[model samples]
Target: MDGLFLLSSYAVKDAILIRPFSLADIQSVMEIQSACYPANLLEEAEHLIAKHQQSPLSCWVATEHQKAIAYLLTHPWSGDTPPALNTPLPPKKPKSDIYFIHDLAVLPSARGLGLAKRLFDTAIDWAKQEKLQKIRLIAIAGAADFWIKQGLSPVNDKTLSHKLDDYGSDTHYLEAAI
Candidate 1:
């Protein structure tokens, strides 16, 4: 009985898809973002759209029957200022490029389905396409082990020159060579 019978006729695999984010998907992305993050932490759809437009290849969405269920957005990060919401992004600096995973979220119903890893794979592929030197993210509380299992090592905040003021005490930084 490798494949068990189900009461419902519909198959789950047919319902889900992961694809690039489009302008029309912004609202759904925002909704998932709001549900996943705190009010102060949620990035606006406009901001996400702008980034998507600038680098559509770096943004992706997981969909189920054409409904957006998850999203992940990545961008280049330099050592200067942290990329804060609605803040003026500093001019791009020249160097071996590094990618910062700015946002990632999955609907509660869609959790435990490997959607997050798929989104992460999308980011890694984008980094390789752009020839980025590294990929990094700030892991929230209860997620350090998850990131560690993904091969991202915990980095000392002082080494990254990250300001502690913006992040909660439980937040930790992780990085991996792309």
Candidate 2:
């Protein structure tokens, strides 16, 4: 559960395997990204790959029938402000007790099956295993409620608001203690 390759089987309508993401899963991840996010929010392959390369243990995919249906992208970070969208995380992030959840997406067809929560649990499990202090993420558009359900409260910080313009309006920065 702590490592990237640890797989969890969910007994949903269709059997889903929550497993580590690989470079080969990029296209399927993109399809899910397109289905879940707007053009401006969809991440490029290089950015996704960069995050995986930098922190493979923090990234994972939910696969059904050997195809990616959902994914969670996370990486260690040292700040309150999240990184820029559509860009690879810069090397040498400051040392801190937190990690940034860059993105989480599930295919429309896979909704209502609890795939989102399952993927989220994987990331949370990792955080707990690592003794991480916090989990930070941006709740884009209509995602605030879902994140709230996961125990993250909206963070009212000026640095985050000014830096998140590329993430569009209605984005809320949220964080929760692990």
Collision pairs in model 2 = none
TM-score of 1: 0.82
Query: Best lDDT goes to which candidate?
Result: 2
Candidate 2: segments with Cα more than 4 A from true spot: 1-14
The total of clashing pairs for model 1 equals 0
What tens digits encode model 2's per-residue C-alpha lDDT throughout 1-178? 5443333333444577888999899898889999998888888888889989988988999988777899998988886668888886879555668878888998888898898899899999998987889989988979989999999998878866787888888889999999
**On a 0 to 1 TM-score scale, where does candidate 2 land against the true structure?**
0.89
TM-score for each candidate, following the candidate numbering:
0.82, 0.89
Q: What is the per-residue lDDT of model 1 for residues 55-163, given as tens digits with 9 covering 90 to 100?
A: 6778899998789999987778776335665454455566637788877889888999999998888788878988998777887746778778888996665744455
User: What's the distance in Å from true for residue 86, model 2?
Assistant: 1.0
Please estimate how well model 1 matches the true structure, expressed as its whole-model Cα lDDT: 0.76
Candidates in order: C-alpha RMSD to true structure? 5.6, 4.6
